[model samples]
Target: MNTQEYMSRFKRFYWITLTALLVAASIRPGFADEALSRRDRQTGFLVVAEDRGFIGNEEIIDEFQLFAKTRNASLIFVTDERTGKYLRNSLDRLLKKGAERIVVIPLFISAAAPRYELVHQLLEREKLDVPVSYTRPYGESYFAVEDLADKFRTIPQPADTNLIVVGYGAVDSDSERKMQADWKRIAEKAAAGFGFASINILIGHDKKKKDDDAVARTEKLTRELADAVNGDGDGGRKTVVIPFHLGPKLDSMMSFDARLQQLLPPGTKFLADGGSEVRADANSATINLATWLQREANQSQPLAREDVGVVILSHGSDFNWNETMREAVQPLMKQYKIEFVFSMADQPTIERALRKLEQRGAKAAVIVRVFAMESSFRKPVERMIGLDIEGVAQDTADVHAGYGHSHGHGAAPSVPAPRIRTSLPIQTVGGLGASPLFAAALLERARTLSKNPARDTVILIAHGSGSDHQNELWTQALEDMAEQMRKSGGKEFHAIRVATWREDWPDKRAPWVDKIRAMVEDAKTEGGKAIVIPARTTGQGPEDKFLSGLEYDLGSGFAPHPMFVQWVDEQVRVGLARFADIRRTGMTTVEAKSHSPYPEKWLWW
Candidate 1:
């Protein structure tokens, strides 16, 4: 137990401690690198442009790449119309680099451009397994309009000068026509904001077989425009030619502009510049494009139309309900001028929305009712506009015959009727009713929850009215929808039953709830699953509250689905077309009623 023994024991203990420390270090996990890897996952952006050398093309690519880098995503640029080989190579490289997702952004004037379709076709042919998303071309975006307006603000107006906006025309006649029409619209909007003697939109692309003939036509149009400007006054009037385009000016367009300048009469003053073309590559526009791409990527869907106004009307209640409805209709706003309105709630009423649409100069207004069946709101809406439309009335005399009360919570309240009027003709379409579209929607929901429809019973539930006539209508509509589901479902379901929230005359809500519970219980006893489909506008409401604790799979109500939106669009089209027909043919109310889809009893005009 002297110095030698102490030294040996100390050495052994030190070695053991060192070995344990090394083992612990080897097992320890490094999380910093893993966090960085997730934060820097590879994202690919395939920019499809018309021409490689087009003005601002390089700038756009650079801006987009820098933007992507900020988001830790990489970008790959490919000129579409120039060649297919380059695009293919770019896409292949992006895939080989292990990009998690690739987003294709067409740097074109309009989504309607043929080049946009070409990119889509090429992508479809490639059939890459990687997740891909597409964004609307820059021209179709409202951001483009804003960019143009900002650019227009920089120009100095002479008060007597006429503004001429020119667009690169398409080879296809229809495309050229549409392009011209769109350019004219742009010119009108731009002119409205500025004081111009007159504005004209000239198409640079021509359908003529001979280039010389096209040039001559262009010369004549330019001369005519110049003449109009010069004839406005003896002198001091100037013509400002604005080349409305995205990038490197085409040789053909420059030559045409030269010819237009030369065709002007002696002593005529003219100036031709890039005009709003510079805005294409501006920082604001680039930021807008970046923001849009990010949003589309997050949502997994493109935005709605920015030109058309859409009013989504629903029977709103709480803040949560309104917010839910807003989230549901948000995707539609991407492409449309959309506003959410509450029929019975506060703020942004139908009348307010109609005025807003008029102020926005909306080409058309679509009033979409998010209700399932015909409600008391419709009559009030019609009366507000001084329209007398006959609608389904409850037969109170037959109340004892099993129909409920004529009026209840569902009835429209007796508020002072709004006298708001509009010069724009209104088209009041019915609710979901018993349309085939609603049937299809219900069937889809059923299939989503059905494990084995062959051993499942489906129950269609609606917010039934206390009115005897209304309940009858609801029952008939529900039965028709159920029958449709059966036919389309093709024996997948064992049976389908239709029920309402309100019970017959003597009994109230309890009987209907009991009936639904019994149906579910019977289905379960028979070794079948019960699927309850809410036959209302939205998935929310009293259906869940009324049928709580029932062993059943509940399907969502009709709103928020793409099919519902399509139905709304169809209704808008039908209503607008009918109004147009009535105006064109000078048709009487009776004549219109004869052609109406709704029953004559329901027509109040």
Candidate 2:
């Protein structure tokens, strides 16, 4: 190669490398810069970050820019490096683009990272002050943990794997403790999603420290890895190491990979190199990091209790039935702000209700679902509200399309389905069907018709589901309610039986209705007055049609009862607590079996 040609190519490569290491870069207010032009109001995000030491992953970085654009926010990505001039310039440019204020987010995985104070030092140097707000670092984000778990799912059998999570540590002793606590939570969240047989969490520092504790930890981990590899039988269990470490240069990753090779067991799968290799701008290029930014922006304006609202999701019915639900819900509005959504988790209806709540200045919403079973229409509603992942990744390409998730190119402008777009932070609490409170309420209804407990056979019937599995769940719920009722006051009743009318499907309805009729006859023949109760949310249903000439007195359903309103009030409280936890911890999984209804909950899905 000629000297002139070689020198020219070297210069180009060097400048490209240097610019990528810029420590600080800015997307102007509302991305109004000519290159990313969009004239929109801005929320300010000063994402405190460090360099991600890998290459070839600009697609993730673009997602962040796309997020910034959609968020109508100004993002000034900062690294606590000697880039004060660059930092100042980005800030100045953002302000010049008309952002009213700046929110400085130390976007580290741990708040204890020593360089975080560098942001303050750099800011002090400029001294041209405007309103500056600070939210906590990205350490507490549950979505970031989810991102790790997303990687964990790649292993063939998560149930048999041992997980080792390496944390990027802080230098300060107290900071390190706090950082470790956060990392432990991160690991726990990941474990909640995938069943890792065992998990070990260790803080991985930029520079290795020479200390007894660090040495002991290393020895213990090394011994475990070795034991796993050398174990008998079907060989040792597989180990998966997830590192939270990052660095400014490519060499850092190479060293990390080498160290992992030594620390990991022989059969371990070390995926330091992946299909989506980090490139160009690795530090500010992750959906998790971007979500952290979005979370910070949301938390910037915490809602007052009065500013938050409530949503009651119920299965809708005809005029009189619907009116009964509306009337029952009226008293709750006096104590709390509420919107009643009467639909079987219809997405468009939910979107309309959530937006209406947002328009009413509700920054947070407590959504309470009322259904015959917790599993009924719950997943679809949860998915709509971002509580669940859209699908099981079957037909992954198609699944990605639903969320506007693009590969190798860019993110789609908008998501088309399975999610509703709204600014309100929502936390849903429901499965009233599984509550002891509902059981007590049912008992109250039975009490009104019981002239003699010994001679009474209470028949609890519900408007049932079509799926045999769901019908089974419905049966269990009824049995649970019957048990609760027994414990409450109905113990002396001859028997409390449960049945479903299979109210909707014609193919199944006839047989179930016949079964319903036969149960009344059995009660009558047993010399007990049959007290048939519609365990519904409103007025008594088609029991009159089926029970026709059979002599059976019907008890009122759950509506208009003081306990029904009490259940709503109690759920509001739970919803509020969950919302607080989500906002405080930034967990995206919502309630993951956190409030699971029945252990056999899997049958509903």
Candidate 3:
């Protein structure tokens, strides 16, 4: 169809869709009156996502309508490809429906996209009586990475898995490059936690797929993929393919399995992310997007500070563990209502905390997970809070078609996962592995045992994950913290090293213990005393059991340190600010000034 003809049909369809939405919505007994009343007090919201070709899933459409009604905002959703023709009408519709002011959400991966500019220009040129605000795109947000990670979690074994992500790129070379860069950013962050043996990203281009070059391009891609899975030393590793395109139609268009079947190993499989004719991220049709919308909708309507609460989620074992966590976070009670839950994202425990916060009249909550890395316990916690989802529905179809797996090589979860419901505006901050505070804590612990910087080798140790990929990540997190320490007066130490003892994984424990012993032996050759310090949350974790013959001083981990309190306090402030950020800039943290948890008389250690 011609541009004008296609637009005419689309506009008619758009009008019919909204009209049908209104008619269906009014049928709810008392919802219409209450919703219209709420919208009267809220700013209108316009969210534009990419043209994913399929935007008409009834279940998805109902979710969006309900999201709009709950926010009490005249919310409109459109695609980037249709905005030039559809946005003006949508804006007019919002105004007619009762919006005096509006917020435009261009939900692209990066603000560098040309659509980002067109949005501001269109808003300026088509100025209505109502005021409007423009915000940044998803652009490097943790939420976008979490979106992909949710899909990866279902795979059986991440550490031993080889990942191949197939993407449908922009037709233009320059646009394609930018798009690939953004995709790489999301891919890296999402995969960092998994420690996949290898990651291969393939972006397909129309120019290469043209009739003239199709055969050559097919041959080239075949060889390239063969080398990736076979000759590149990842041959034996289990490989999982992700079709990163908008929908299942693209999967058929690519004909991935038919073309590459000869190259794949027997156990190779595809992740089930395209259950929907259209994937959620293509059009930003996710509950994560809805939660973000809820946050923005509440921007102008500020809740009192007293109405906000903080929930500190941590790992606890026994009485000493839980009590130490409580003592560490006690100072936070002065500034905000606080509830500390020391469980591994336990549903019942988290629900009880939410209920307490609700009883305290909290309209919002900041969830802080206290672990070594951001990816730790992230999926389960997020799914419980209704912020992320798994691509479960498509698995059945993939397996039936013989391109999926029925079981995984990795160990299963110790407990069942159960989701909870809540209406509070919630923002969650991840672990403190990368935090300067954590690095400083490590330095302080080392200092307690270091008699002479030139003669001491400080070894930082932690209880690590059973998954090899996760264990590698734990080691990397400790290394990152060590780097931070080295920059901040840790240069005075003779040497600082990092290690992860895969404590829970009996099969993996002996090798890690041997490595620790070798490091200690290396330290002794230079007449250096090895100072082994626990990098754990609290207590000595199997350090003595493994290092019995070694001569090293073992200092308490972060348990008694004042900086631990500071880290929790910092997260609380950051979480609150992120929840209220209407612009989605990802720059939600400010320096902790007078509110620093450390008292002058207290030692940092």
Per-residue accuracy of model 3 over 209-275 as CA lDDT, tens digit each: 1234444544555565666666436546777766553321222222233234433555567564433
Query: What does the lDDT come to for candidate 2?
Result: 0.61
Per-residue lDDT over 208-300 for candidate 2, one digit per residue giving the tens place of the 0 to 100 score: 222325444445556755664444223357666666544333343333444545677556666443412232223321645554455456656
TM-scores across all candidates?
0.42, 0.55, 0.49
| Residue 110 lDDT (model 2) | 57
lDDT of each candidate versus the true structure: 0.55, 0.61, 0.59
Worst 10 residues of 1 by lDDT: 24-33
The lDDT of model 1 is 0.55
The residue-level lDDT of candidate 2 at 93 comes to 63
| Per-residue accuracy of model 1 over 1-605 as CA lDDT, tens digit each | 44234334433443443343322211111122233243234545566654323223344555554345423343333333334555566666555555576666556655445555566666666666766655445554334554444445555653666666666636465776767776665555444436667676655553222233544454556565666556566456666666555433323232334444555556554444423322232333343555444432322222124424667777676787677777766655656666678654222377788778757745445566666664435554544433331122332232212233321235553222223434233445657865678888888998899898888898888877676576777778788788877787635788889988774333567878888889988889889889988887776446667767878888887767777767776766665565454333321221233342223222121
Q: On a 0 to 1 TM-score scale, where does candidate 2 land against the true structure?
A: 0.55
Among all candidates shown, the one with the greatest TM-score: 2
